[model samples]
Target: MDSQSRVFAAILTESGREYTGNENPQRLKVQAVDRQILNNRVQEVQVTGTAEDCCPADRVSVRVSVGHSKDSVNEVTNSVSRRLEYILQVVRQHGASEKDTSVRRFLHREADKYHMDAEVLITFSDFEKMERVRSVLLEKLAKSVCVGTPQFYHSAECLSLMRRRACVSAVENAQQKACEVSQLLGQTLGHPFLVREEETREWKNEDEEDGGRCQNATRLPHPSQIPTITVSSQVSVSFTFRDISKKKPQ
Candidate 1:
């Protein structure tokens, strides 16, 4: 073949096609240029951002128990019943609903006397009300009633809200950084092209580096003072860039 035909054949082979002088030989070059232009059309900036949010424990559970041993089963039942009724009443009076309170009993005979023990598990939403209930039970029943320490924790809804807030804050921080970078590059910031949560972590605030246990404390920590749950989120975001010179000023 001629020199021109040979060159065309070589280009066709490189493009993974059979040489066809009848067709446009420059088609492959045109397609390559188009691809380069398309690749340069949208420039992107990738940045990582991190943020944390903390929420105090929103629920507390307390357990109260009473037990009595008497000569007969009826005597034991009546004695335990009185204390149980009183405990339930105090809990209800403090705004706790029946659904939030659960009761369990154990009855048995040892040697000759019969024994009965009852427990009331209460979940409280209001710390002050729980304190009042605890105080009344202790003052009225005294040592007869055993009130367990309150356990504080975050509710499911509270945790869900905290996680969302942390993730959104992280994304916002990433966008802010991307905007600054684009400005430095003399480009306008466009809409985000990609967003991904790279990592997430949750732990008690007490585990923080700056936090430490208080030794020789005078009083126990209050319900509200309980260690809060801290959630942190790290996100990777890619934002498109627009030419500042081509943008119309608002």
Candidate 2:
């Protein structure tokens, strides 16, 4: 293959949410403040992937969130840090026994004066183990921290995997497409002498809001009313055309 051997590539993205129980007392409170927190957590868990496997580089981002009073930033920060530390300890205890399990990245944010968010990224050899890690974190967070449940999202990885797989499929599809185009133009398709791929990333806020009579909202009977969260990813892809030649009259 020459340096200019052209081939076509494309990207595909996908998203999924890891579900768990929400047992926070504040989540079930009839007050609007508590209701907002519940809604936020539910929306966070409901995120869905745009493509199936691969994600674009630029679209790789995560959102972390927590609910607290305006003056509680310091307290919230310390609480979140301790919670994460405990999570890391859990990974060290259980994950160390296995391979390809470690912390990839961790982030913290204050969406406003009243809310604190922590985004934690953990990597494992496979999805099954990743699920286990999520479960472990949820348990630890519930017991160790007074904050809402901690959620995990494979935002970029979801899209990245989709893109990688799509690229492979796109090559096959592009080859067939090129062949059809060549035949239609009364020409023969030459071997791909050049191939290139282009991609872009976009950020979007997936927000969910409910407007209804507060008095009518159903109330959870228990404090352990498992919180719901949604995680999602977005991206775009383009494939370029390449190499053309004419066939002799036959």
Which number leads on TM-score?
A: 1
Q: lDDT by residue for model 1 over 75-193, one digit each (tens)?
A: 99999998899899888888999999999999999999999988888998888887788778878888897777766778899999999999888888888777777777556788887
Worst 10 residues of 2 by lDDT: 42-51
Candidate achieving the largest lDDT: 1
Q: Which stretches of candidate 2 lie over 4 Å from their true place?
A: 1-93, 96-144, 155-160, 201-250
lDDT of 2 by residue, 61-172 (tens): 1112223334466766676666567666765665443333333333345455544544444444343444455455545554333221222234455555655664444455
TM-score of each: 0.76, 0.31
The positional error of residue 138 in candidate 1, measured at the CA in angstroms, is 0.4
Quote model 2's TM-score: 0.31
Give the RMSD in angstroms, all C-alphas superposed, for model 1.
13.7
lDDT of all predictions: 0.74, 0.37
